[model samples]
Target: MTRRILENSKVLITGGAGFIGSNLTETLLNQNNQVTVLDNFSTGKMENLLPFFSRKNFRLIVGDIRDLDRCREAVQGQEYVLHEAALGSVPRSVKDPMTTTAVNVLGFVNMLYAAQKAGVKRFVYAASSSTYGDSVSLPKVEEQIGRPLSPYAITKYTNELYAENFHALYGIDTVGLRYFNVFGRRQDPDGVYAAVIPKFVKSLLEHKSPTINGDGSFSRDFTYVENVVLANQLALLAEAPEAVNQVYNIASGERMTLNELFFCLRDNLAAFDLEIGKVNPVYGPVRAGDIPHSQACIEKAKARLGYAPVFDVRSGLREATKWYFENL
Candidate 1:
């Protein structure tokens, strides 16, 4: 894939005001792409995109994907669509499955239809690690997915199905990236469904004891945000026809227990504040719809999409800790 493909190209990012979306927006804008952000701001914070407001190549359209007409409007004239908008979190989906299905599943179909109608070149979307639910596999492969454990996981899995069907039925190129515990700067730490990393960082920063949902033995392949952005970029620019219409694991290809993650953060953050290393986490019951462990086999992605993760968990954690310490 050449840089010229993204340069001066019109790209639309759904949920552009959110953490991953905002990061992608910044990267694409820096690369001289004309980027349009479509976000409803439900979970996405406006502050995330504040830095890009003045950029001439950046545009923000406050809209929801649940509305088909709005999806059509966002897809128009856009050569590529990076669909990142979704209601994320297992507990949130369990509490409100209807809304989750509406946004993640129905909204996904709306985007696909609109993008197909608009003749968009590629549709790259966010799949989830939760799709490996109940499988108990050490290194998850793309083909061997288990039944979804939560409504959120179900919605993401359904998205892969829809994207594949869209490709088969309509010939619209699609790529699904199964993200594994992505974390970085600008990740929200104050919400009910806040991800573990940011939430832990925030609690430790405030000198509050972070709560571990389980025994801290549950592990994840905590990939960094920049790696995910690279996967999206490569998926958009992939030349091989075999790479299109397939799913790839976007991860660091390593796993760390929650306890290990906690200590790593503490040790890293201790450089800024000596007292941070002393903070201990409170262990609690395991949350529902969570897998015991997760790791990824990235050979498929390496062979197909040329994805080489730039940051491992420890390095990514160091970078993320620095950002949270300074920004939060």
Candidate 2:
């Protein structure tokens, strides 16, 4: 009776009002699942859920994960938990390491504790490619890791460590998805800590020069949001016990330099009759806590969770560009 094999499941997505969380919420609701969104709206906005406010199976609770009681209440009667709440910007973390540590580390532990107590079926949370840090590996594998260069990376790594210990000690099933540069619709571009794609798109639209950090040589495996949603879905549905208590890299499995992204955006905009010529990007010093390059080895995810990313960087950028043109 289930459509797409995900009907009537009780799903909980922490930070469901944020970019990735909102996308996951809409996708789950479309599949006829009972969905609950736990968000404090610190970085997330209420407008993100404007489309699904009327859905009978969808509910939203404005609360902080740091509050254990609220976390427990939100986890009650939920089968799957997608914990995506955290202060995401590396630069912001560099500026305010203490707040980042408290929310990302302490709040994550609180959510895990509450989810464990509620007997959740699976815990799938947002890990990051930044966890690779200074590995210098071309395609970052799951087993090999390096010292975290940023506080944000450190917090995400801590999430995986906590997940492993929880499974070993408490028998809780958990999966950590190391998301690469995820970008697409609903990504906040107006903020100081905004991710690159949205920020660039906004800058280009406004005739402002987009700043490229580190001479645009620093590359990233820019992933789309849909791929991350697919990873979470697979992590929750995978029957192999080995899939649990493990981490998988969720990305397009390709790389792009910031310079390449800039030109691509310019060209795409030109196609829409928005001619932006000879866009000379402003160069800035390298960020305080940024890895030089990052790419992902997604074969392990394919082998274990059957995770397949449908959108590449170009495809995702095209989609995102269209969204910006229409919405902005």
Over 1-328, each residue of candidate 1 has an lDDT whose tens digit, in order, gives 4332367799999999999999999999998999999999999999999999899999999999999999999998999999999999999999999999999999999999999999999999999988888887779999998888999999999999999999999999999999999999999999889999999999999988999988999999999898999899989999898999999999999999999999999999999999998899999999988889999999999998888898899999999999999999
How many steric clashes does model 2 contain?
A: 0
Which 10-residue span in candidate 2 carries the lowest summed lDDT?
1-10
RMSD of each: 1.3, 1.8
Can you list the residue pairs that collide in candidate 1?
Answer: none
Stretches of candidate 1 off by over 4 Å are: 1-5
Q: Residue by residue across 197-225, what tens digits does model 2's lDDT show?
A: 88888888877799998899989899988
Best by TM-score, which number?
1
Clashing pairs in 2: none
Best by lDDT: 1
Whole-structure CA lDDT of model 2:
0.90
